[model samples]
Target: MSARNAMAAMLDELMGPKRNVELGKDTKVTFDDPDICKYYIVGFCPHDMFVNTKADLGACPRVHDDNLRLEYPKSDKFEKLGFEREFLKFLSRLDEDNQRRIRKNLEKLKANEENGQKKEDLRKLRDEQEIARIDGEIKLCMAEAEKAGEEGLVTKCQELVDKIEQLEKQKTAVEERLNNTATIPPPIDESAIKVMEVCEVCGSMLIKNDAQCRVEEHLSGKMHMGFSKIKVTIEELRFDNGSRGHLLMLLDISVNVKDGDHVNETDHVIEIGEGGLDRVHEIAIVAEVVRATDIVGMIVIGVTGTETIATDDIVAK
Candidate 1:
C-alpha cells in the first residue's frame, strides 16, 4: 500500500530468490547485501572476537560488544559463488500465478505513477501480497504436518498433557496436605522454642542435662516472651547475723499478662533486673551456667553468635 513497501515488494520480486541463494552460499559475490552485511559481516559476535582472532566465520559470536565490527567474507578473489546461483534457482521456481499478478500490478503501478498515484505505494502493496502468500503456504505446511501426527508434534502434545497431569497431581497433593494440617491445630505454644533460653548460672527450673553449660550464665542475650531463665549470684552482704539473704532466685520470663494488663508494655512480663542490685549485669553470673559441677556457662557466651556452636564444660572460678 505504501510507496516504500511497494518498492520493497518489487525489489523482492526481482531479487528475493537471488538473495536466498546468496544467503545459502551457492552464488559467489564480491560484496554481500548491505543488510546481511550489517549483521553477519560488520557486527562481530563478542565470544568469537575474544577467543578466535582468525577471520573464519564460526557458528556465532560470543560477545555482544557494540564497538566490534562485523567480520564477513568479502574478497575480490573468491571461490564458491554458490549463493547467487542458489538464489537464482529459488527465484526461477517462484509461483507463476504470483509472478503474473506481480507483473500486472507493476504495470498498473507504472500507469498510476503517470496518472498521479505514487509508484512507491503500488510497490509496497505487491510486496505485502507476496509475503502474505508465503506466510499462507507456510501455515498450510505446518497444518499438514500437525494433522499427519509428525513425531515432534505428537511429542509436544504428549509433553503438554503430562505437564498438565503433573500440575493437577501437585495441586491435589498440596490441597490434601493443607487439609490434613488444618485438621491438626498448629502448635499454639511451640513457636517460642527459638526464643527460649535457660540461665545455667542460676539453675532455673529447666531440667538440666548437658554438662556443656554448667555453673555459668546462660549466654542467651535476650529470650523472647514466655521463655524462662534462672539467674544466680553470690554477694558478700552483711546480713542481720552479718549475712545477706544472698538473693538467689530463678526469674521466670514470660508473656504473663495480656495486652490490656496494667504492666503490659507490649505485654512482656518484668521479673528480674527490674529493681534493686538484682539488676542484669551485677549478678556476676557464671554466664550460661547449668547444674553440672565441671562445666560453665561462659563457654557458650564465648561462641554465642555461631549457629551450631558446640558447648564445653565450665571451669569453676
Candidate 2:
C-alpha cells in the first residue's frame, strides 16, 4: 500500500471509533453523553465546578454554564504548540497497546524525516564538490593561458572563468542555506500534525476543517454529477426495461438503419413518452453506409418537432 494510505489506516486505528457526543442548544459547546471532556482530551479542562461543588458526581461534566463553555484555541496557537501538546495529552490517555501503535507510527515519521535530511545533505555535498572541481579547472585554464599567451587559449580561459563564477555563485547560495540557522525550523513530530480524512467521492485527502466545504464542492462538480447521472441511468435501466429507449436517447446513440429503408422528414411522426410530434422539422444524414459492418435498418426517430436537434441527435439511416 502507498505511504499515505498506510498512515491513514494507522491513524484510523489509533483514533478507534468516534464518540457520539451531542451538542446542546448553544451548539458551540457539546454536552449530552460526553464520554470524555473535549478540553481534557486537548490537555486542559478549567471547569472547577465539576471538581469543587460536585466532588463525587458520577455524571459527565456540565459545560452548559456560560463561563464553563469551552472555546477552541486560536488558529495560530493551534498551528504552533497546541497540536503537539494536545496530541501528547491524547497519547497519555490511551492504553499501552494503543500508545505503542502511535509510537511506531511516530518512529516511521522520524525515519522519513532523517532520510529526507540525508538526501538534502548529499545534494549539497555534490554541489560543493562540483564548485570545487570548477574552481580547480578554472585555475588550470588561467595558468595555460598565461604561459601560452595565445588568443584561443585566452578565450577558453575566459569561458572557464565565467563558468567558475557561476558555480561559485551557486555554491554561495547553497552555503547561505546551510548556514542560516534562523531559516532552519525545528523538526516536528509527524504525529503532532492533524490527521486528514479521505473524501469518499473524489478520493482526495482533506483535513477536518476544510473537509465539509471540499466535500460539498466535490458533490456539485461536473465529474461527480456525471457519475451520479450514470448511476441513475443504470437504476432506471434495471427497473424499466421497455423505457430503455428514453435513456438511450438521452445518451445520443447512433443507430444503423437498413439499406434502401429511408425516413421522410415530413411524413414520419416522432413520439416521446405520451406526446407526439406536431411536425417533422428537418433531417440531415451525416453519413451513408460505405462499409459492410455498418447496420442497415429503418431509423425511427421520436421527438417533438419544435425541439432543437443537436448534431448528436442524428441516428444511422
Candidate 3:
C-alpha cells in the first residue's frame, strides 16, 4: 500500500472505538507520561521505557495555554494539532539562518575554484615568457659581441653553437636508439687454425699452415672463418637440356674481389662459381622492400619485378 493510505489506516485504528479516550475539554498532559499518551501522538507503542523517559516533546506550551481556549472551539478536541503548528514555526526560524550560511559557503567554494584555474593559466603564460626571454637574450648577446669587436665574444658564440650541436646529436641518437635494436646472428661451427710450437733455440713463432705445425694437439689447432651465406629464391631453374623447375637454395656467398681485396656489388645478385665440379652459384634473397624508406644494413630484397618459384625442386650443387 502507499504511505498515505498506510498512515491513514493506522490513525483510524488508533482513534477507533477500542481504547476510547477522547479529549472533550482542554486536557493537561506531560511529556513524561508516554505510556498513556504514546499511541495518541506518534501512533506507535514505546518500545523502551528508559528511552521514553529521556525523550522530551519540545513543543511550545503557549498553544496549549488554557487562556487561549476561546480562539478555536475544536482545538480542545485535537491537542496534537496545536503541537504540530508550533513545531512548524520552530523549523521556520532555523530555515532562514540556514539560507544565509548556504549562500556564503557556496560563494567561498566558487572563489577558491576560480583562483586555482587562474594560477594554472598564469603558470603556463610564465613558461611561454621564459622561452621568449631566452631567445631575446641570445640575440642581444650576439649584437653586443658584434659591437665590441672582441675575439673572446666570437669564441663564446662558438661555445654556444657547439652546445646546440651536441644537443641536436643527442636527440637524433635517442630517436634512433628507440627505433632500432641490434640482432647478432647465431654462431656456426667451424675449424680453427693450429698453433705451432716455438723454435727452441731462437724462441721464434712457427707458421701455423706448415705441415709439421698442423697438429690437433697444438694450442690453437682449430680455425673458424665467418662467411656470409646467401639463400636464392629462384622462380625458374633451367638445365643445359632446357628442363625447367623451381628451386630454393642457400650457398656460401662472397663479394667480388676488387683492387685491395674489397668486395663490391651494385645490386643483390651474385654469380657464385665458374664451369667446374666444385663451382657453385650463390644469389642474395631480398626479404622485403619499401619505395620510400631508406635501406639499412644488408638490403632486404623482395619479389619486386621478380617471379616466385615453386618449393620442391631445390638442389645442392
User: What value of lDDT does candidate 1 attain over all alpha carbons?
Assistant: 0.33
Q: Number of the top candidate by TM-score?
A: 3
Residue-level error in angstroms, candidate 2, position 305: 97
- Candidate 1's TM-score: 0.15
Against the true structure, candidate 2 reaches a TM-score of 0.26
- What TM-scores do the predictions have? 0.15, 0.26, 0.27
Residue-level lDDT tens digits of model 2 in 1-317: 46776555445334422312254433332222243354443333333212322121233232222222233332323323233233333333322333354465556655766777787788667757766775777677566656555555666666666775776686677567666634544459743344444433223334557558776886676434433443443344323323223223322333433333344443322223223324342231122111112333334444444563432234332
Where model 2 places Cα greater than 4 Å from the true spot, the runs are: 1-96, 150-167, 170-317
Clashing pairs in 2: 257-296, 257-297, 258-296, 258-297
lDDT of 1 at 55: 20
Off by over 4 Å in 1: 1-160, 175-196, 200-240, 243-317
> Model 1: per-residue lDDT, tens digit, 152-204?
67766555555545545654554454445344344576532222223322213
Residue 110 in model 3: shift from native, Å? 1.4
For each candidate in the order shown, give its overall lDDT on alpha carbons: 0.33, 0.41, 0.33
